[model samples]
Structures are given as C-alpha cells and as structure tokens.
Target: MKTDSLSAKAKTRIKRPPSEVFAAFADADLMSKFWFTRRDKGLKEGETVKWYVGSDDGAFAFDVLVKELRKPERIVIEWMGQDGNPARVVWTFEESEQGDTILTVEESGYAGSNDAIVERALDSTGGFNQVVVAAKALVEHGVEVNVVADHVP
Candidate 1:
C-alpha cells in the first residue's frame, strides 16, 4: 500500500509511565475500563480475540488476531471484518522527555478509496484519542474521563 494514501495521524500524550500506558492496552480489565466496550479473553502474543460493539441490538464487531506483542513498547494486531479482508492496527508506546509516555495508534489497510474507509478512519481517530485521554486521567489522577460527554456537543 502507498504511504501517501494513508489517512491523517492522531497523536496523544498520556501522563503515565511506559509500563502503565502499555498495560492499559495489554490488560483486559484496564482496556475494558478505557478502550474496549466489553471484556474478552486476555491479550497475549499469537492469540485470537473477538469482541462486539453494541449492547443487545447486535451491532458492528471485529475479530482481531494478535500479531506481535513487545512488552511496554508495541503491539501489532490484525483487525478483520466478518468477510475477512484486511484491516490492521499498530499500537506503539514511547517514553517522553518529561517522563511521560506517548501512545500512538496507527490503523490502515482499508480496501481502496472507499468513502466508508474514510469515515471509519475518522471515527477510529476520535475514539482512540478519547481512550488515550481516559487512560491518562485514570492512571495519573485516579479519575476516568468521560469521552461521550466531551465528544457530544
């Protein structure tokens, strides 16, 4: 895939250490508290996890297979739709100069120049940004940031 075709990048800095920030993704409980809408199996290298989005109405879902798991650094996973084409998510954790951790989530591999792909990318960017902020608030100040309140006008 051409790099130029990729969508815009979203970056967020969390006021937590690398381990804490990384654990926010790897730990199922922590992830459910911040990112994932529901709980599933624990995250490990070479494990396949499935989770749904909506509650009772049966909405969109994703089946992700863990590809790479580098502790406190990076996690790479393949996000496939029900049809199983090709979607990807790369989560990276970096140590900042001020002793904070920067988490960068890069997702790509949407089919072609489909308008739906653009919408999905934008929605994912907003969700990830909110999750990062929530994780930061939880880890640093022991408070959870309500993203829906912030996102909704």
Candidate 2:
C-alpha cells in the first residue's frame, strides 16, 4: 500500500544569540533541562543519540540519527514515528536584527494514513512550540518552566 507523507513546521523568536539558542538544542545537558528528560550525549553528525522523556523508565525512549549538523545554524536528524516509519527533522537557527534568534523546526516524511498523518503533524507542531518556548525561558531567563513535560502526563 502506498502511504502518504506529511510535514510540520514551527518557528519562534528567542531573546538570545543564535549560538546560545543552538546550544540549547545541540547540548544534551541543556536540552535535558527543558525538553527531554535525558539524552545520551550532544548531537553529532553521523551519530545516533537516545532521548528519554517523562519518567525516564524506558517507556518514552526514542533514537535519533544525526544526519547533518552545522553549528549555530542548522541540524538534521532522522527518527521513527509512532507508526515506526523514519522521519526527518530539521532545525534552522538565524540571528535576528535585534540580536535574538529566530528558530525554525521542520519535520517531514511521516508515512501513514491520512488521519494518522494529520494527527501526527499537528502533535509535532504543538510539541515543537512547547519545546521552543521552554528553551526560550531557560536560555533567556535561566528558568526551567517544564512546559513540555507538563503536557506529557
């Protein structure tokens, strides 16, 4: 059966430099503070990383293969979706005129039924929004708001 693919994109402006905002996602230590509960290590091209969320009891664990990594600019990774199909996630970081960073997240290659693809895309949009907001709070204000975790359970 031929399956349809879907994609989602989200953008946010953070009150920090592009390097700082990029570090928030590239560095496992900083990412764990706001997004995932734990990550094996920092993102590197041609490497795979495991990220755990929620309780970290192995219930919500996923593996991400880093396809490309450009410091303070862009990162691309492939991960499996709920349907067990691999999907690509790309993150772009651009420095704004006001010294802030404009972060854009795009996920594509979702293969499934129409309803499933739409649902997954919507969920990704909301999830990425929460993640960027949380990262903003943590990086700009030094506060761990836990917005992403709050939506989990």
Candidate 3:
C-alpha cells in the first residue's frame, strides 16, 4: 500500500526460460506484443530508444537508456520523462527454484521529498506491476495484458 514518494519493486512469476523471457524484452517486436505496442530502435549499450505509444489520444513519450544488457539474464534501463526526471525502471530476470523465470522490476529515483516520493511511488508501482504481469502472460501463455485498464490519467 505504499505510495510514490519512495521507490518500489514489483515481481512476477513467469513460466518460461530466462532466455525466452529476456528475448521478449530485448527484441522490439516481441516487446510490443506485451508492453508498449509501438516499435522503435532496439536497445543497446549507450543507446537511447524513444517509443511512441498508443494512439495520439493516449500517447506518451519517454526515453529508455540501456545501462546494462546481458542476454537472457538481466537488463537495466533508465526511463524518464521528457524533462529527464520522474522514474527509473530496472528489470532483472532470474530462474526460480521450480525452473520458472522470475522477473523483478524496480523503480527508483523520484524527484521530491521522502513523503512526495512515497506518494508518487504508487503510480510507478502500479505501472510496473502491470508490466511484469503482462510479461508473464505474453511469454508464458501467449496472452497479452492491457496495462491501461483502469489506468488513471
């Protein structure tokens, strides 16, 4: 029940190999199926990709900077608004004890005081929770999850 004033982490269990799940993220086409629909340049070290999400009515613009990229294991990216501030999402992929893959999405670096950061953290938590779930569905069951459902603003 924590809010956005502080950072938060979301986790999901996906019944897929780490490499496969990782592919769903590294590949732009694969990523579009579960996450943002729009396709842009793929992520690479020292590369920043811009995505034009959804229609003009609900379009959101953001930049993703690939900080660390390791195939089928981990990906660390910094996401931010046009002003280059707001949130940073770090996605970690690991194999679980049951052989399933676990994806952990952590967001930190919010602009504001401790109270304000924790309050706004809710917004980030909700987005990443949905994203991780969507990743699980798309990779494991071939189902697509709509993150915009009941989305406020």
Candidate 4:
C-alpha cells in the first residue's frame, strides 16, 4: 500500500504562564470558552472526549482520543479528520523568560490524494491558529474573541 501524509503547524505566544496556558486546553470549561463549543470532559491521557460545534440540528461532533498528557508542558491526541483520515495533533507549551508561554500546535497523518491532504493540512493550520489566538484573548484579557464560532457561521 502507498502511504501519503501531510502535516500543519502553528504557534503563538500568550502573555501568561505555561500552567495557565496549558489549563486553557486541558479543562473543558475553559476550552469551551475559547475553542470548542462543548467538550464532554476534561482531557486526560488514555481517555476519550467528545466535542461538538453548532446547535443540535447542524451540530458536528468528533471523538478525540487523548494519547498523552503532560501538565503545563504537552498534550497529544488522535482524532478523525473531516476526510475520515486519522490525524494526530500535538500541543507543546514552553515558558519564556518574559513570563509568557509559547504554545505550538502540530498536526499530522493526513492520508489521501495530494489535493485532499494539502487542503486538510491548510485548514488545520488555520484552525489551530485561531484556537491559540482565542486562547490568548481569553487568558490574557478575560475576553472571548469567539473565533471558533465565527469560523463556523
């Protein structure tokens, strides 16, 4: 069998500590405020979480398998992409000397036609970028930018 894959990466520096930034992703409630519309539970290693977007009629849902979780540092998860390909997403949090956290998101394992792989990778990059930006706004200024929701509708 032939194997083809693509990956996307995005990074952002938030004016907050690593712990705070990490919590923004680990906790379901906090994440809902910035990213996903709703998450069934907090992220934990070896656990599965359901995330939903939009209302009941038009809602899109997906299951994320938490592959790894390191508090204030890193997290890895696997989920099915829009194209039905298994994708792995990694989040890394690094604390800088200026008392800020640099968060990086990498997603890989898009397998399909060249065009489909490229499209998925590009979309993942933009989505992750919006996630981090929304997280920064929520964490630093206590404001929800609603970037995730904005992208949906």
TM-score of each: 0.78, 0.90, 0.83, 0.91
How displaced is residue 146 in candidate 4, in Å?
2.2
Candidates' C-alpha lDDT: 0.71, 0.85, 0.75, 0.86
Model 4: lDDT equals 0.86
Model 4 Cα lDDT, one tens digit per residue, 40-78: 668879988888775365678889999999998999999
Model 2: per-residue Cα lDDT at residue 45: 99
Name the candidate, 2 or 4, with the larger TM-score value: 4
The local lDDT score (0 to 100) that residue 111 gets in candidate 4 is: 86
Task: Kindly list the per-residue Cα lDDT of model 3 for residues 44-140, writing each as its tens digit.
Answer: 8778886557636567756788888988788888877433465667778889998888889888877755566765677678878888888888888
lDDT of 1 by residue, 1-153 (tens): 343355435578888788988887788766656555445656778988865453334645567789999998999888763334477788888999998888888877766446666666676677767777787877778785645434553
Number of the top TM-score candidate? 4
- Global CA lDDT of candidate 3, please? 0.75
Candidates by TM-score, descending order? 4, 2, 3, 1
Q: Residue 100 in model 2: shift from native, Å?
A: 1.4
Candidate 3 Cα errors over 4 Å, as ranges: 1-5, 55-58, 81-86
RMSD in Å for model 1: 3.6
- In candidate 1, how many Å is residue 142 off? 2.2
Model 2's TM-score against the true structure: 0.90
